[model samples]
Target: MKHRFSRMGVRGRLLLAVLATVAVALIVMTVAFNYLLSVSFRSDADDRLRNLALDESSRISISNGRVTLPQPTGEIQEFGTQIWVFVSGATVSSPNVEPNLQAAAKSLDGQPAQYLDVPEQEVRLYGVPLYYEEERIGTIVSGLWMGSYNYNLRMTLLATGALALVLLLVLGFVGRWVLNAAFRPVSRMTAEAEAWSIADLDRRFEMGEPHDEVTQLASTLDGMLDRLAAGLRRERRFSAEVSHQLRTPLAKIKAEAELALRRERNPAYYQEALASVSQSADQMTRTVEALMAAAQEEGSLARGRASVWQVLEEASASVGVLAGENGVRVRVEPPLRSLYIGVERDIALQIIQPVVENACRFARSTVILGAGRNGKEVVFTVEDDGAGVTEEEKDRIFEPGVRGSAAEAAEAGGATSRGAGLGLSLARRLARAASGDVEVTAGRIGARFVVRLPTG
Candidate 1:
């Protein structure tokens, strides 16, 4: 089965993308908000400076092209050197002159009305020529230092940046926690699967109530587990059936062979009878070996590193004699790469033999032994061009000693069949032991047995 644990999948990727987008947007908006706040504060300061200049400009009077100031108000006095200047053509009087104002004054002399912004001091200086009776006498200049405004702006930006950084960090932590919580079910499923073993095949994953994708996945896994448990039960019953069906014949052969030997009458008859007994014993031994291999497969103890394609080739080689006897040819499909995983060779060989033998028995022309993958699972298929099984018998074919009408008829007609109806049952049992399964395909053309195994 292909699970979500090894992959980040859609949900995790989407969560990460959303978090990144939110963080970027929050930072951009925070910076813009701080910048706008600084501009608003600066605008208010400029408005105050403009009003102060208007109020103080009227206090100064011009006489003989000279500027003079009356006693300034207490409110104006508090401003100290941070003052306003009134200048005429040859007279200039001020409560203040900045160390850098000499250049500013000369620059404003030729201009009747203008505003200049100085980069060095972060100030906006306005020089307006004052007039009485439409005759311009001198100019009035005002200085607005932007130091406090700049300081406030810088602080605001720094504070907003810090807050944004903190919030992003907090959000990252919260996101990680939320993601972990959201994936709790998946994590639980992983832990449970990891702890699960073949000895406790009946156990199943507990599903949650969310009924989302995770729940759906759990439900699917549960269904698979149910099938596996049921298959195991069927295999157990099949094993018992094989034992019952084969024991009586073996006992009869043993008794008859022993009696013929004891009588020691007709040397030729005795020799023939002894050979027949040996044949029976050999057949019985092979059957027992097959059964033992099947059991090992069912126990999942047959797992070792083996190539699937090589196994199929070996099975084909083993079935060659039987295929010839039944007038059947084995065809191996191309592009079968030798991929190896953990699986016992004996178990794999035993599982494939009976399937191939049965295919030869029913096949009219050819049997193809092939292997492929269905997603992450390895699939081995034995397909024959013969009379396909009927729908009614398809489900019962893998039950030990439960032969279908055609197979039974072949047995009754003295065809010297090798099977006592336990072949497929044994095959399925062994396949399951390797964490794999066997199933009859749904097609109507021929008999097909497919074995599915996990790659990991």
Candidate 2:
């Protein structure tokens, strides 16, 4: 049942919900009205019967210790036609009055007012006592038949029920029509969304300004589409960049391999060619790995927010491990105020960790991490007290496969450079994905890498 209900469209559900509420209210009112009307009609009938009995009783005269009721004629004749009157030994019955009700009325002479049942009808009987001084002379008993009252009330209730049923049917259809009209905007949006394709990511609902719920919904869907378009574009750019960057290394590997295979050579010559091939493959691998991370953002930058200090702390811990292994000290300077950014902590760490680790890997003694709020951006700094970038190398330092001055220095000094120049490239792409960037400048003591991201 629940599943069937869930399967119903919004229009059907809305119509049913409204109709059901109105139907329940109508039923309650009908029942209560029937009760109130029935009570009033029966009471009126009882009063009419009692008044007739009183008039007849007043007309009677007592002479010489004998009671004489008026004859069933004149004004009494009309009244007697709708009531049952029993006075002493004389009795009068209404037309078609039940013998059972007459007998029940006689029995109620000394009792309180009560109802007597006859077949499918009822009679309300009221008894009055007549007395001479302290002695009881006679009893006046009267009753009104309730069959007509019951019939009229039953007909009224039946008509009320029929009217309610008609209203439910009418309103059910009308409500459905109204609801469908109201949701027409949503239907249009659904159709438009269904027609959308990945190839047409730029096509948007573009609901200009949010006014109502439907407009708000359209605007939200457009926002989601915007994110999807941005992500797809980013992925495409990353793929293109990866292909472009990997081509040279792949060509080098192919040329070297083909050249070495062209003729037989000594072991030392073959070993040199194999090492060159291995280096090219390693460079290509690094490029692919970095580009893949840049491509697979998972909508994290668009949907997440975290404290800037927390991200710095976590990034510092991650870089600290690599720093300790390299005999370099990592120091994080506390910010003056708590700052939050639009990027998630893990993603911020992803973007910052690479740059910080690169600094720690190249640092002579210590690397300092610091952060501060600058206008609408959260700026992060990673400074290494090591050989800084030369004026010529700073221009193309963030480019993929550029392996700048630090890598050059490490290579010249016979130290292992941890990356194939993709770390800074990946870091810059990550920062830009979050509406920020990574830039390098000559610090007072060493090289400084600055990352700026949107503040929350």
Candidate 3:
């Protein structure tokens, strides 16, 4: 039964529940009404029988223990009351009464005042005793036929039953209409939400402030869609950034391979080409690993702790080759106190290495890498003694494919700028994924990039 009920749609279940409650109430009301009506009919019959008996008793005359009844008067005849008088071992009754009822009245010959029923004759009888100066003379009995009352009561019962059924049907239709009207908005909203989720996640119900259940539901769904759309956007941006970052090294690797295959070169020349290919492969590996770590962080996967000092040392070492080629001295200034950050060792290295490499690319002579504690975060600052970033370019420099004046100047001066301007963007993105941020701060004589990560 429960399973079958559960299988019903929401509207069906609600309607069934409403109908059941109303049905119970209707049944109770019908029973109570009929019971009260029956009581009223019975009370009326009893009162009529009692009054008739009293009137007949007053007309009786008891002389020397003999009871006499007057001939039927106008009032008694018009009222159609049956009267019976029993005196001195004899019974006298009104004419035309059924034999069963006459016998019933005779049975009350010596009885005191009382009421009784003759069901077989549909009659109620009340008997009153007549006394003559403390001596019992006779008894007078009055009867009221209950045929008309019983017929009226039966008709009432039928009428009430029919009315109750009609009311039930009417309520069923009204209740069904009310439920449909109420659920219509919900159905439409649900359909719209499903369609939006599949095709247009940016679309929203745009209903104003929530003041009711329907509005509240719409608000909740809108919030969920917003989060989903943001996540999708982040995923797409990450893919594009990763592909862009890998292109430089991938092209370098391809160029080296093609050059090596183009000529029958000496062993030393081939070795140098293979070395270049190997370096590009290593760069590609680092780019992929860093992006994958950022992805894992965004997905809320498990993250490990790394020593701040160790990460700085690793970042400096990773870009040591670039710094040497560019005649830049990369210096790591150790913190006075031991510190750890809430990120994996490789992820921390990836986050800081890009900034250090960028500094090496544009540094005049010295690039300083340092770590310090900042409230609840570990802050790493990389400063390069080169053409400093203009105030207007600080934020734009971190945008993908957007380079600062320093890189464009180097390129215009016929100096090779190894960076494609994606490093800072990728670094900032990774830092944010780990609940941190990278920003370029105003420096005295160089561009100071700050990376902040949560403390372990």
RMSD of each: 16.2, 14.1, 6.8
Better by TM-score, candidate 2 or 1: 2
Candidate 2 lDDT, 1-456, residue by residue in tens? 889889999877778789889999999988999999988997787778668667767776778866665444322224433444444545543344456655765676655455544444455566766566666655666655566777899999999999889988998878888898889888888898888888998898876899988889888888988898988977765665666555546666777788788998899998998987887677567556645655665334544688887877767755544676679988889899999888766567667877887898788899999999999999999999988888887759787778776777778889875566766776787788878989989997999999999988
Q: TM-score of model 1 relative to the true fold?
A: 0.50
- Give the whole-model CA lDDT for all candidates, comma-separated: 0.69, 0.74, 0.81
Residue 344 displacement (Å), model 2: 24
Best-matching candidate per lDDT? 3
Residue 82 in model 2: lDDT: 42
Better of 1 and 3 by TM-score: 3
Residue-pair clash count for candidate 2: 0
Return the lDDT, model 1, position 131.
Answer: 73
Tens digit of per-residue lDDT, candidate 3, span 277-351: 787788778778867767765644226899999998878766655776689999999999999999887677768
TM-score of each: 0.50, 0.56, 0.68
> Number of clashes in model 3?
0
